[model samples]
Target: METAVIKTPIGYAEFKGDEQGLAAVKVLDTATVTVIPTVLQEAANQVLAYFEGSRTTFDLKLNPQGTAFQKKVWQALLKIPYGTTTSYLELSKTLGDVKAIRAVAAANGKNPLWIVVPCHRVIGSNGELTGYAGGLSRKKWLLDHESPVKQGKLF
Candidate 1:
């Protein structure tokens, strides 16, 4: 399980695995790795493409570790379209348990795949941004970046 930690404009990101695939990508402020494999190269490239808005979906493979509920939330997160958002309530109902909003939100916070899984696209029922582990500011920036048309004053 070789890993590479690199500094990006957003923050320090540690990528594990090789160009054949990626296992996980962790966002950190500081970290060190003893070794890095070749697959992390492709992971880094794919992530860069995502930030550049050139990629809508990841082509790399991943084997992230999480609880079953967390995995389900992450899988649903992937279904959310780029530049769009879904409410926690919507996610709960869609998952066949409308009462699981809190559980859904918890899983969303635990999303280790970050931008790839797109936890940032989940919002409050009233359409307000909320509960982004990366912080609301970063979430807003990511959404604005992906928007097909920037919000503007109609005069």
Candidate 2:
């Protein structure tokens, strides 16, 4: 599998995949990877555009490997509109679990597709930001960047 690492405003991201599609996008705060290739140029561009608020959706093909429950959770996460927040309970209910809140949360955390899957949009029941593997501050920045309020203010 080919791999590349790029630095974003929020953090450094490692992109790995092959001819099939993107396999992983691991965020790291430091430079750890040896060689950063230029493969999947479009995907990298799209990621930059997303951070710049110039793109609201992604078009790259992905092949995130996860369990069935994690896949289901990640798929549902993609349906959340940009700039909006949903609770873990809400996600659980949407997935027809309603009682699988913790399980859903765990799956959400395991999502290999970051910003694209939008697990950052899921929050605690009290409307507070919850644990984000990418870091809470970065999560806040992403949410703020995509917020309709911020967009409206820019106009």
Candidate 3:
């Protein structure tokens, strides 16, 4: 897989995959990259646009690798609106099994597409921010970035 490590507002993100589509887009503490493969340029631009608040949704071709259940969880996550959040239990129920909360959370945790899949939108049942592989602070940053109200914007 071709790889591109680019710096973002929260941290460095390593984007992986080629023309087949984006396989992964995970944050890293540090990294240096000299080239961004041609296929990933659009993904990179979309990510930057997201941080810039000029884009509310992603439209890239994704190819995240995971088990069937995990893929299902990720797909559900994509349905989460940009400024909205959902609880693990809600996701579990959506999958037709309220008892699958833990399993759903586990699959959510394994989401490989980062912001593209929006795993960060899943919060605790009581509205508290919960598990985020990219770190809670970064999760908070992303949520804040997507917030509807801002100091200057009317909408």
Each candidate: RMSD to true structure? 3.1, 2.8, 2.6
lDDT of the structure predicted as candidate 3: 0.92
Model 2 misplaced regions, further than 4 Å: 32-39, 151-155
User: What are the Cα lDDT values of the candidates?
Assistant: 0.81, 0.85, 0.92
Model 3's TM-score against the true structure: 0.95
TM-score: model 2 vs. ground truth: 0.91
Candidate 1 contains a number of clashing pairs equal to: 3
Residue 141 lDDT in candidate 1: 82
47-119 per-residue lDDT for model 2 (tens digits): 8899877999888888889888888998899899888899999999999989999999999888887787789
Candidate 1 to native Cα RMSD, angstroms = 3.1
lDDT value, candidate 1, whole model: 0.81
Most accurate candidate by lDDT: 3
Worst 10 residues of 3 by lDDT: 145-154
lDDT of 3 at 60: 92
- Weakest ten-residue segment in model 1 by summed lDDT: 30-39
lDDT per residue (tens digit) for residues 1-155 in model 3: 88888889999889998888999999998888548879899999899898888999999999999999999999999999999999999999999999999999999999999898999999999999998999999999999888887658668
For residues 1-155, write the lDDT of model 1, one tens digit per residue: 77787666577678776444566777776666334456577777777787777888877687777899899989999999987889999999999999999999999999888787889999999999997877787788888988889888989
The estimated TM-scores of all candidates read 0.86, 0.91, 0.95
